[model samples]
Target chain A: MPEITYREAIRHALAEELERDENVVVIGEEVAEYDGAYKVTEGLWKRFGDKRIVDTPISEAAFIGMGVGASMLGLRPVMELMFWSFATVAWDQIINNAGFVRYMSGGLINCPIVIRGPANGGTGVGATHSHTPENMLANIPGLKVVCPATAYDAKGLLKTAIRDNDPVMFLESTLLYGNLGEVPTEEYLIPLGVADVKREGTDITLIAHGGAVLTALKAAELLAAEHDISAEVVDLRSIRPLDEETILKSVRKTHRAVLIEENKPFCGVGAQISSMLMQKAFDDLDAPVLRISAIDAPAIYSPHLEAKQLPRPTDVIAKVLSIC
Target chain B: MPLLMDTAVTTPNFDTAPINQSLTSEDKLRFLRDMMRIRRFEQGALQQYSQGKIGGFLHVYIGQESVAVGTVSLMGANDHVITAYRDHGHALAVGMNMNECMAELLGKATGCSKGKGGSMHFFAPDKNYWGGHGIVGGQTPLGLGLAYGIKYKGLTGAALCFMGDGATNQGAWYESLNLASLWDLPVVYIIENNQYSMGTSLDRSSAFRSCLAERAAGFAIDWDTCNGEDIYEVRAKTQIAIDRAHKQSRPTVLEIDTYRYYGHSVADAKHKVYRSEEEIERYKQNHDPIRLWKARLISEGVLAEGKYDEMDAAAKAEADESIKFAEASPWPSEASISEDVYFEVDRQTIAGRTGKHFFND
Candidate 1:
């Protein structure tokens, strides 16, 4: 095993897939020559040349729509939005064209396209730039939404996303890009819609994904060291085809659950998880399921305000303590 | 200070460009026959819509046949075609089977889009016809991307993107045109300026009422316009655009001044209030593309008077036969409810074992 950064893992997945499939090309603003805005696609241009790694103009609607069209033809296009919030400018192409093309064409067309970029808010990019919109994308019927918390999951899941024959929304984290985690030297793939139990316990399940997964893990460690309470950390890698069985199985054993996310509290991923648990594992719960999410406000630019806006480890710990 | 509206409207010079001299008698007949077929088929669709046989939006291409017939006829085998919702005429012009198109309108399995896409959305990938996009300017970028793919694959072909007069006002349209020019992608964006955008006329919707083609000058792209009532003028103008796209990988902005005889869609009543009966009757009688082309064919001795009448009858009969085929086709089965939501082969194995929320087995 080798410790690698999440950004490196994503680059590895993109480079390897681009090498494996001639049809797979990367298209985005600042993806090539500039080596990506966040440098997630660093050095790909030198290795793959200009055609495979395309640098597009600042036209989200045009490039995203082009991705849908190119995917419809034959090529597999990996479109990158500099930030997830920019997707609002291209909503028609994402939802109407990419999401409905296959269904509308009666399976005759498949958008083998991946719209990937950082979607989490932590670096003080403000309301417009900072958005954890996995919940919004997952709500679409024909799309697959994936948010990987670790370097290993990023490499494995992005590879699977490129190979999959449907539109995939690959949500990355601004905070997690620099974080390091252990990754195996051998090739591996983590299937979409499968939940990963990062740490096991019996007292309560602190469920999270993406940036909040790290928060839950830190909370679990604190809960064990300080309070001597065992907390299970469940990382929901993929949110759309949610692994309900894994979630319910963990809740059944723990008898208590606390869902955490960086998204706003209203109609967030936590809302869906709570409703599902209330319906499926009502009798198994020892207490009502609690949610630890960002405060119901736009992501402010002030560092202190941003800290308060997003879910912190202390918030997750408090939720777990309240539920347990 | 001079006002912008005071500028004289310089009518485009496509009518003066010499007609394609290589056209044979059969090509001339085809130009006439194709326009006639679309006009008759749309008339049939309008009658069906009135009788409650067709559902969803039925956008008839009654008056703007020359635009589709002219542009699509010049496309090569490898060239791609895409258009907005007023697409029945575009599909037929590209040689899509009439029965499947009719079946699609009737919501039957035998439809070109397998009954999934109604009147606003139709796709035939094998025929190089990308779709019949519903959203006004939704197809612009997609069409540009198709051209991008053609260049990416090293194909010596271009893509023709058809859109309504209203679609030019959308942000996507501007974004697509800018990129097409910046990248030198082989694409021709045709604005089928059919007078009205739903019920709002071009003058009301656009700031530049005199010429939509001049908007291309902002992007440094080549611009052209044609009188879409005459097939020869449309053919000559579109041929220049297509040649530039295919040979030089240059983008062109072509705005054809066409009109829709019927309302925007079959169910629309605003045309009655927004426009006058006299104006509609005038377009039908004087500037009808089919009638003008038929009269030209007879006068030029390419077709006789009796033979022209026979061709008109045959076009109507052909349209009627398609309706019969659509009436006989079966509705899609319930088992296929969620079949195409995702490509089943690439789906994760775990997805198959679970009870999905929005999709079926």
Candidate 2:
């Protein structure tokens, strides 16, 4: 058990997967000589050399579609996007080629490709650069979207995503990249479509994912120390194959729930979870499932306004207080 | 599969490539028969479409048969192919059974894509045929990846990625072409330039001089153009590009002069609005790949008298049988609609058993 940043955990997962399978190649822009766009793939090219680690021009569609194509031939491709917001440029390749080809081809093709990058809006990268697209990708049926909130989950989930025989849309956070957590020295893999309860409580359930999980955890701490309200934190590590049982189980016990996320409130991941809870756990709930999300608007470029634009511990606390 | 389907203007196409000389009369005749099969198969599909047997967009390769048949005939075991929605030509050329292809058009359980892909997406992995992709220029990058796989695995093979004249305008294709040259990938981008992309003519859509593939010059890739009607010309030019890919691991942009007799797809009933009746008739009566190839063989004294009739009858009969097979086939089960969405879910792997893949009914 060694402490490492989320960035290191991701690099270790990539290194392990590359070592495990020679067919796995790292493909992206600025990944080779430039370390990486965000230093996530730092030192990988130095270790793997030119053949294993490839750098493409600044064209997301070409490389993303190429990864989809290469994956069909049994070569597992792990493609990196500098920011998931740029995925819009390559929407046809990302959604149509990588996401739907498996179903379209009747399983004759399996896109064992991972398109991962930083996706969130707290850094004031503007609407062009900042996007929280977990729910957007999760809307597609064939894709497996994961937003690991911690170093441990990042390592375990990414390793599985590379090896998994389906197309995986791995969502990472620029804000959480440097956050420290304990990751094991031994090799470990986490299965997709599972949820983790980050902290145990009984009064209310604060449901969150990706960077918003940290906000939920902070809210849980404040609720316990200040308000004396015991709040449970459920981190949805995977978005598509949503772990409804884990989420419902926590809500069933707490009898109160609040959903939090950085994505816009309209048709957000929280929207889907709320609908699911109402249908499945209507009798067990004591309060309506409340949601705290980024204000429904484009990510503002102003740094001062962006802090308020994204989800915060205070927002999660207010939602919890209103519901519980 | 050059500038397009009707760029059939006579030009002295150089057949200097040694590869074309290796083709025996038997090989040339087989190519003729393959092209004829595609042509007749498209005719039969037209009949099905008229009768409401097939569903969705039906992009038949009626006139551009030689482009798919000629280029696919050049593939070795390691070589692969991927093309646009106008794909029945390549599907048959690569050895996909007519029953499966027709069933796919009918949306039956016995389809090549198991009734999922329909006309715009036909795939045969066992035959090294990746798919009949729908989106314009989307298959280009996938083609690069297949070439990437060849290079990564240290295999001496090339990926033949096919597109239309309109696909040349796509930003993805330029990006793919740039990477194809920069990476020295073994990929030959074959444009089955049928002049019109859907209802839009090449003049209105793509901006290029000489041919659509001439734009490949910007990427530093070698380029070639040839008549699609003559199997020998298509084979010779494509063979050189394939050789460049296999031997030097270099990419090539080959524009094959071909035509599509019907509209861009069966859905474009207003196809007559753009192109003239005389223009369409001239192509069918004179430059039709099947007719042109047949006349070339008869003049060469290689084809037996009435042998063309015999081959054409057999192709028509095979196509007719496909209709019967499609009619006899069943629709995919209601429960099976959820299947094949994920490999793990279909295979019932450990991960598949754990979660709710379909969240809503």
Candidate achieving the largest TM-score: 2
* Per-residue lDDT of candidate 2, residues A1-324 (tens digit): 799999999999999999999989998889988999889999999999999888888999898988889999999999999899999998999888888888888888888899999998888678998888888898888888999999999999999999889999999999999999999999999999899999999999999999999999998999999889999999999998889999999999999999999999989999999999999999999998899999888999897788998888888778777866
**Candidate 2: where is the Cα deviation over 4 Å?**
B1-10, B13-17
Instruction: Give every prediction's interface RMSD.
Output: 2.3, 1.0
What TM-score does candidate 1 get on C-alpha atoms?
0.95
Q: What's the C-alpha lDDT at position A119 in model 2?
A: 95
Weakest ten-residue segment in model 2 chain A by summed lDDT? A315-324
Whole-model lDDT values for every prediction: 0.87, 0.90
Query: What TM-score does model 2 score on chain A?
Result: 0.99
DockQ of each: 0.58, 0.83
| TM-score, every prediction | 0.95, 0.98
lDDT string, candidate 1, A1-324, tens digits: 889999999999998899899999999999999999999999999999989999998999999999898888888999999998899999999999999888787777789899999998878778999888888888888898999999999999999889877898999987889999888877788778789999999899989989899999999999999888899999999997778888989999999999999999888988998998999899999899999888888888998777988888888777777766
